[model samples]
Target: MTYELYYWSGIQGRGEYVRLALEAAGAPYRDVAREDGDRVLSAFGKGIETPSFAPPFLKDGAVVVGQVAAILLYLGDRLELAPKDERLRLWTHQIQLTIADFVVEGHDVHHPIGAGQYYEDQKPEALRRAEEFRNERVPKFLDWFETILERNPAGPDHLVGDRLTYADLSLFQVMSGLSYAFPRLMERLYGDYPKIAAVSAAVAKHPPIAAYLKSDRRLAPNEEDIFRHYPELDP
Candidate 1:
């Protein structure tokens, strides 16, 4: 059965990770939000039977799952984007969860006080949060990945071993998200971490990814979701 993905229609937001992975794997799936305009809100208004904690949900056959990490975990296993070895599989999940945490922190830098509140309303607090994220969190996260890549005996052709995995794709998306939201800050930091940049650029140039990126369906970055550009938040 064909898989179905649901998320906000416009910006790629959190959903892009799943989209990029699916696209790269050449898997058959429906981006439901993009397929039917207004469908995202209409379905959302109807509400989930258990109440959706958040969006970027997926439906495959009888199973329905939400949360970006959960969706990717499911897809990674089924799409062969994850390792078959138990240890490596768990490690991949661990990294993916870490990436999820990083994404949440990035979002919080913009909406430090409240996700429900506007950025303008929380500008002062947001500025303080963004500064910390820029100077501290950004380097730490990048360094963590840098360490992982450096230790990989497989020579860093990808995040895990020599093949592409969901974690690498997610990392690529995170790198892109940060660059879009914090261009100047990334410019200052990314230069120091060559492996991270190389992997991100390689993911973009991957054949299937290159085609999907060229397609109109690939949404552009905007002021929403985990990443948002605020000039004042940058140097």
Candidate 2:
């Protein structure tokens, strides 16, 4: 049976991680929310015993899993998209978590003061937060990943080994999300991180992902998710 993915419709949000892995693996899965408008709310209302305390949950046969990273791990193992070595698998998870942290920060840039509030209402606070994100956090995080690539003896084909892994896909999603949200800032800031740029481009150019990019199912980035665009947030 094909796996079922439940997440908010329209925006990719956290759901895209699962989507990317499934797509790249060429695995069959149903995007439940996209199929039904109320699917996400219905799943939440049903009080499903979610593993990660969030949406973007996955249902694989009888097992239910949540959290983007965990979902990727589950899918990676089942689909053979993850590294086979134990050490490499752990490293992939570590990178996935770091990407998750970056995602949370991206969400905070617009909702720095309050996620429940709007960009119009939190403009002043968002400006301050975005400045910090653009000037400090972005470079720091990118530099850390760049160092990982430099330290890796594998020549950067994968975050862990020579094959495509979930972490590489997540990194691609991060780059795509950031570019959609802050095109100018990304262009300006990403210049220093060659490894990141290479990974992003490579993942996008991958056969499965490249085809997905050309498909209609791929949702466009918008204001609803973590990587939101705000003109005021740009420097």
Q: lDDT: which candidate is best?
A: 1
Candidate RMSDs in order: 1.8, 1.5
**Which residue window of length 10 is worst by lDDT in model 1?**
42-51
Q: Please list all clashing residue pairs in model 1, or write none if there are none.
A: none
Can you write out model 1's per-residue Cα lDDT over 99-182, one digit (the tens) per residue? 989998989999999988899999999999988999899899999999998888888767787888999999999998888889
Q: Each model's number of backbone clashes?
A: 0, 0
Error of 1 at 185 (Å): 1.1
Q: Which regions of candidate 1 deviate over 4 angstroms? A: 38-51
Displacement of the residue 179 alpha carbon in candidate 1, Å: 0.7
Give the Å error, residue 106, model 2.
0.3
